[model samples]
Target: MKRICFLYCMIFVFLLMPNIVGATQSRDDGLSQFMFGISYNELLDTGDIRSHKAEFLAGEEIQGVFEEYDTLLYDKKNGYMELHLDASPCDCPGKITAAAYAKRNGGYLFLRNKETTCIYRHVNGIVASEPITSYMPVGFGLQMFLPEHFSLPKNDEAAFFLTAEIPRQGTTTTLQLKQIPFGLYVPSTTLLIDDAPLALADKAKEVEQINDPQLSLENGSFYKTYHNIHESALIFFDPEQFNDEAYPTELPKKELQDMLLSGNLSAIGEKDRHILEKLGAYASSYPPITLEHMSERFRFFYMVYQVEQNLVWDTCTMEWDSVAGRFRITKKWLSRKKPASFLEFLRDADFWVAAC
Candidate 1:
């Protein structure tokens, strides 16, 4: 009787083991889904290519806010700035409405809502023209033009303040984000946002645990310059039409390099040519910057291109050029792996920037 009971117990334990193991794994997978980069295709298509996975979550009161790039491209030339608020990734309880403001005198009542407009427009990448609202799969993006005759704020100040309101059941939750980069309106007070959400104490703890470097880089000088260069590159090479055969022939390789050095953007096609022309004209104001005279901080931007475009061999020996007073490429071997994109090339060269 004892032997028979032991056998039965063993069978029961074996039957339940798979269920226990599978349940834990399923929960882990679900948690990872909310982590980051799961929406890369969506973000990339919409030109929100910031890959750093810093996430800001709010408790049950509001769905989470995910920023692809901590920074928005500041288009000094066009006088209009755009932001993509991705609420699609979050689970919403109700409708979410937002407004922009300029912080002044410890309150957010300076800039009136009438000065801003939420319009659906995209220069390139994913076609997300829909204004951001609750429970949408595609997410929301808006462009706000600077008030007429207002100049850009002095270096690295908050352009304006953004406030998000979430109405759940009978209660309404108001969330504010601070210290955003350059925008049209200027506030008397700096708009540095406190990372900790005062509403949800528990969720704010989770946000505090994220130690992403991109958080700091968002406001750094290198990042700002990198964004300008990277976005300008996209304008010149519009990734959507990049694979098109006729596109490459439209601009010669030398001309493309010159464009970068001179900070000029040439319109490649009829699509959004006007914007391209504006960008081109604006970029032309900067004097020519050559690799030889490029700053050490920005040298990686040029080196990545050299390794991909100018390198003849997969491997090369650097020899000191006495006359040039710099390292010169001597021998070359075939690269073991070829990168499909500029970001991939940067990684392959082992000179990766956090933003990339």
Candidate 2:
């Protein structure tokens, strides 16, 4: 009888352990290295060549000007990956590297890598964000992103540890983000699985909802009881801090800002031009514009937003620009799903075009 009672208690204790364990997971300080990684199954699982996938957005387009540079390629053998996005008019250099390690489960692998992340400073202090290209490293200095050296595991099924040292700003070791209520932001994870072919996992559920609209650490965070994300409440950058207008004196006089909002692409600094061309392949879906024709309706462009599966999602609300001098268009990301004014469109883009 005692054995039976003890067995019942043991089973009941086991059932409650998951919730107890999950509650104790360590949270993060407001400032920690931000990273994303994809596992190479060929190196870890079966000996098969699989094509890993990733997406990027180059945020600059000048009239008739195209810059070229190397785009990040996902290597399946050693699992090295890189992503670069620069909108800086200054000649700045930045680089990030990535690699993969074996997960204990054996069926899956955990990615370990770090890259540059952003935060906003409004009024008194710094507000954490998922790093936007609103500010670029000015002048010339090496932006060293490699934390530490790592070696690939020779045995596909073996577990190993490698040393890495990623740097972060500020005095505090804790990772914090603005706009998000405390305790929601947790450590992030990303994985690319191998099925019949390689496939990307659903991030929200798989990675603890770091990308969830409600969990956003943006300046203007929004919450929703329904399934829909509140587009109006989101804010990408503080307008006062990150100016949206083009300063004539700051730009070169080689070409008219017209025909293109940024003038000739060649007019931009050499480093910027090179980065533009590197990310040029992604320009098709959201191409830069030259100038506004009378026949054309919208001023700037935006990548259409969708809830999932790349389906078109948006509603349109007209907004008029009164200052209207020379109408020039650049490849801007405009979401069509929720009809909103120019102000609201920007707010929505702030979250959509974000990094971990």
Candidate 3:
């Protein structure tokens, strides 16, 4: 009986050893990296790659190289696996080296330069020929990495690539290819806005303000001020600062102003519309008010109120830009979902309202 028990213990130890070693190896491997499809388009098509900066850590260095562009071959290499890109120059000098690594779990690229690193995931396809013409001016730089993990697409075959046109005099020996795994996806988690009913008086007052004409000027000062005030309100109400007492029946004017100015009001709920309506009315009734006044004011207020009530979630914020006359909402959690306007927000409200 003693011999049988000892054999069972040995078997269990043998089975567990591989798992322990694998976990340790994975940790040491670092985080994954890739060039997203969007980044490629922006860098190659629009020539705006420089605007998207990358962050680099100390003791890390990145260099660029030039190479012949071939779309079919590029697609073949990247289509099977998920790819992401960090940064690229608009043009390369000669024999541009497309720097990249195998996408793995919990892997990242670190650079010796202390620069910001912007990552892009590979979507599909590559340029068959270099985008820049010979002798034409081209920008070239390397994206350095910080010691952090980044999310990679799930498919294993995809690879992220970045190219830079290096002058004939450029150096290639500095380029390094490292392999790392994709990291866990972390959502932009936030507190849910409390849903409570709005006050009657506040609602009536906003309706009244909506009828004011002077404030609605297409390009008038009041219109601008009204838009600015509502814009400020969104900033003030940050969901992160919510405590039990933060939402009360009566909010002071100064408190509301503070919230608006702070640009933290990303999570105000519809049940809280009554308070917002009252606030809008109060703003409209200020000195130099006119009939056209409340139109733009009311429009902007309602837009924000609707956004807070209907679109905003724990992981995102919805807002309208009066200057551009468009609604914009962002959900970092739903990476695939594109940024939407007010109408788009309503049309796709169901997609983002889920609890993940």
Candidate 4:
């Protein structure tokens, strides 16, 4: 009878021990409890997977721009949260490399890292880690610059597997987000076209009356030529600062600028032409006079469509006339196709021509 009484007391003590120690075991696998904050378009997620999976435009927090030198850039927002994982004190501060991958085929995308203040560990049914009290906020933030040219089509959804790997600890945790759509922006408007497509005749008529080359260039500017020339020159001078891969042919600075600015494909060789084509496919810094007032519409151009990689002949060119101290469209090309405004000729060439 005394032995039976002692066994009952021990069972009662075991149940009360959990309450005495400030720990709770909601689940056997602690890693499975992670939650992510996914921001789509302008909508913010409250660190809930169900909230993230809801229908919404993704990637408003990330923006892509074609820089002056034609190198693509993606500026991403920091402060994405990974919440509810166990963290414990350890001898070494473990580092985590988090990356986004294509969920369908498991293709690797981009990864970034942050050091963990404490190691996360789970043994049996209990999480051997620091308890996140009600006073403390759960989870940590992650931020990384994805590949410069990485793009996903507008409205086309794909699954993104976000994984955090702690190499030192030999542990990896993954959470999958489905139906993630990416936003795209192109440097040159002509990239919207295929096969040296000609601009529509009717849209060409809109700017036929504007004859001043300076005003004409601004009215229907091709990609930002002046900035492109300036940036290319800078890249050639300071390769460390800017990507030198932009200019593959390796010409002298003045020559490279002149070759790009000239718009005379006959003057430059095949490789130089390839460089020109690549630079021309991105959006220009200056929007056409038509789109200058329509800021929202201009933004739409960047958020839709993939860029084509060919140069159409009707594309405009601008050269600084030192004597006049202003930019002028060269006579050789425009004169050959007289009366066709450079802007109008390139106008319908845009893929968004119908929508615009």
Instruction: Put down candidate 4 lDDT per residue, 1-356, tens digits, no spaces.
Output: 99999999999999999896535322111212221122232222222322433321242333222112111111122212222222323332333233221112322222233333321111011111222121112221010112235443332211111222212121222211111111112122212211111222223332233232322233334223323322333333344532455566655545654433333334566665555444433345543222121222222322321121111122223332333322233321111232132223223222211111
For model 2, what is the error of residue 173's alpha carbon versus the real structure, in angstroms, after optimal superposition?
Answer: 25
Best by TM-score: 1
Global lDDT scores for all candidate models: 0.30, 0.24, 0.28, 0.28
- The runs of at least 3 residues in candidate 4 whose Cα sits more than 4 Å from the true structure, single-residue gaps closed, are 1-204, 208-243, 262-265, 283-356
Q: What is the lDDT of candidate 2?
A: 0.24
Predictions: Cα RMSD each = 24.8, 24.8, 22.4, 25.2
TM-score of each: 0.20, 0.18, 0.17, 0.17
Which ranges in model 2 have alpha carbons more than 4 Å from their true place? 20-33, 36-81, 86-89, 99-356
Clashes of each: 8, 29, 80, 7
TM-score of predicted structure 2: 0.18
For model 1 the local lDDT of residue 104 reads 26
Cα deviation in Å at residue 101, candidate 2? 5.4
